[model samples]
Target: MLLADVVATSAALAATRSRKSKIAALAELLTRAGPGELPAVVAFLTGQPTQGRIGAGWRTLAELGAAPAGAPELTVAQVDAALGEVASASGSGSAQRRTVALRGLFARATQDEQRFLFRLLTGELRQGALEGVMVDAIATAAAVPGEVVRRAFMLSGRLPVTASAAVTGGERALGEFRLALGRPIRPMLASPAESLEEAIAEHASAIVEYKMDGARIQVHREGDEVHVYTRTLREITGSVGELVELVRALPCRSVVLDGETLALSDDGRPRPFQETMSRFGSTRDEQVRALLLRPYFFDCLHLDGEDLLDAPLRERNNALRTVAGAHLIPGESEPGAPAEILESALEAGHEGVMVKSLDSPYAAGRRGRAWLKVKPVHTLDLVVLAAEWGHGRRTGYLSNLHLGARDPDGGPPIMVGKTFKGLTDELLAWQTKTFPELETRRDDWTVYLRPELVVEIELDGAQVSTRYPGGVALRFARVVRYRPDKQAHDADTIDAVRATLKG
Candidate 1:
């Protein structure tokens, strides 16, 4: 299909706030696409190249110039056929050229097609639709069930393969694959829980473990070789050579361990989260190597040749304990009361507790009831001082927020912190439409708003900082919810925050 055709659908999806409308547009594109073009379709729709995450990226617009003269006319099917040809092409030059050639060919198509191609390649269709939604669309277009496609994705760890199979033999044939390792599948995540009591009441006796302040990392090992990737699956193996070497020396031939990497003191207590995060986003191998790290394995997803994702948490934990050996994070029976657990965690200077369901299996990528985090609640009523325009999916929405607390002894309320976390799309849209009226002036992306809206901000804890106008600000602050019940004058005082810091 023409690139313009794809762009039109994307534009339609982008224009609409309705989820069903976006799905319908995506479904139409899947129907128009040929089998061979499935990779490009997937790539375009997902806003990524057909090449996986590790593949070379399209760096510049010039790299995607006009198609060559006298080249055979490319069709949608021809695009699909090129997948293997491009995959097999050797050397960096060939790869670069092929990427350019493919892009140029698509560029030769209509403006609408270019829009679709851009959106697809960039993967931010931004209509509240995600991978799961698109998978269903592909299945629908191919006369198959969504589960069939999802199963293929679960096994192959590649959406292009799943799409090709769905477009060819339908979902039934796609379901015939099994899970494997070395290939990184989606990591399991947890849905946000309201409270500890709510989680325990729902779970009925959950296995609560300490939620340490750290980065989530998954280590894939075989014999004396190890590959470590983050929760986002970014290859960070070169960063922590010591940890890699430690995993390589483990007795197991093949193992996939889920864990956290933290900077801990000699007493086994974790340091401030920023101390660990400071080492991240750095490119220097030596700098990353200098980072103090301790890998605390929590769950065993794979051992030897078997996939342990199917096993219950208790069983997986037992296997993880045996296989992880010295690297395992010690988890004990949860204390009866939340206060006790909180005190213990605080006394150790760690984060809070992570409650995991014993009977639950590893549900990769989906934040189900398998795991839930319970941190100590620190609530502060703060005023919304400024707001910034959101990006990507939240384009045209006011998403970035700056909050402040009262300073009765001062000239102005002290700027506590800014947050873009814990906000729903509804909230983003509401702020986008509402914040402009309350704006003082506009910058490139932010609206400087009067501090009239008081919000109750909750945080992990307070840490000393120079970022905020206040000497101290909320650390890891997120919105508990709008404090409509409280007025701006009634916001929490800096003295109260200072008291917490003293504690």
Candidate 2:
């Protein structure tokens, strides 16, 4: 297929607010894609290239003075191959080679295609082709059930791969996707709860566990080989040797364990989140050894060649107990009152309590009500839309932050409010240096940025307001931390913020 067709469909998707229209357009486009071109088509439509992060930044792209072609002759396969060359260029003079490759690619693309490629490469393509919508479109195009597509995606951990399979062999191919060892699946997510009592009341039998303020890790062990993946499914096996060793020591021959990992102080309290995250980047073996990450397994997805993903939490926990043993997270099943559990978790320097339904299966990649996370303070993962120049003691620094909530319908992030609170001197220095790099444009007072950075904000609550586009504003909002592990799409949605108004 021609690249122009994909670009035109992307424009059509961005022009409409109706999700049904977007799905229909995407489905039509998918149907036209050849079996071999399906992967690239699906990936490009989602605003991400098959070759992730080809090292081309805004500055590099801007420096490429390639003039657009008059007509569109670039094929999807041709563009994909060009990007592959660019991504593979990585030696001493790789920068120049990458520039040459990108320039050549852009020189052949028309104005419309160039614009689409630029946005797609820069992670700025926000045309509502979210994973969920894409899954639906793939199912529609392949004449398969949406649930089948979704399940395949969740298990395979790649929408493009799932799209290829669905298009080639339909539901039968999707069924081939299973819980494979050494391959990371999307971790099951939980929704934020209003309160512990409310969460407990919603489920007949609940397992209340401590909600740790740490990174999520999914460990897959096959015999002696163990692989650790982040919440986003990125492998960090080499960076976390201690975690691999711990998982390898498990009695089970093969297993997939889902849990949290963090560094702890001598007194057993969790260390600062940044300190724990630092281990993921540490290249020195001594540094990693000094700050060991402790694993707290909560769910056992697979054990002894048996898949427990379809089993209820009760059965899964039983399997987890058998394998995890001492490594299991502290939690009470069918507790009389979860209020004490919540209080104990808070006092232990943890985030709060997670109230989970005992009967729910592991619905990977979906944030359903089966698991509810209750924290003492309200926190929302919001995107940094813009930052204003500081005044007084904070002069020259980008201090006040304009935060936005993710639009669930796949539109641009909606500005909710601004806050300069909870920023330390170090944070201020970092922001001054970082925000400019991410700046899309700037005025005299404020610098607008791409909606990429995800910052966790602690607020008293939310209130109905018309000042912001989302019709809700945060109350006494302050920055808790910058969540580097999350992306803009992973930020809390506007609907979630508006729901806070009920509090």
Best by TM-score: 2
Please, what are the lDDT tens digits per residue for candidate 1 over residues 239-357?
77778888888878899888888887677778655466555555556654476788889889888888787788889988888888878765564547655665687678765777788
* lDDT, candidate 1, at 90: 71
Give the 10-residue window scoring lowest on summed lDDT in candidate 2.
280-289
Write model 2 residue lDDT over 1-503, tens digit each, in one string: 99999999999999998889999999999999998899999999987999988888877887799999999999999999999999998879999999999999999999999989988887778888988779889999999999888888889999999999999899999999998888888878899988888898899998999999899999999989999988888888988888989899999899999999999999999998877877777466676558989999999999999999989999999999999989999889856757788888888899999999999998865578999999888899999999999999999999999999987777779999999999999899999999877776789999988789999999988998899978899999999999877888788989889888854
What Cα-based lDDT does every candidate model obtain? 0.67, 0.90
TM-score of each: 0.66, 0.97
Alpha-carbon RMSD to native, per candidate:
12.4, 1.6
Error of 1 at 160 (Å): 2.4
Model 1's alpha-carbon lDDT is 0.67
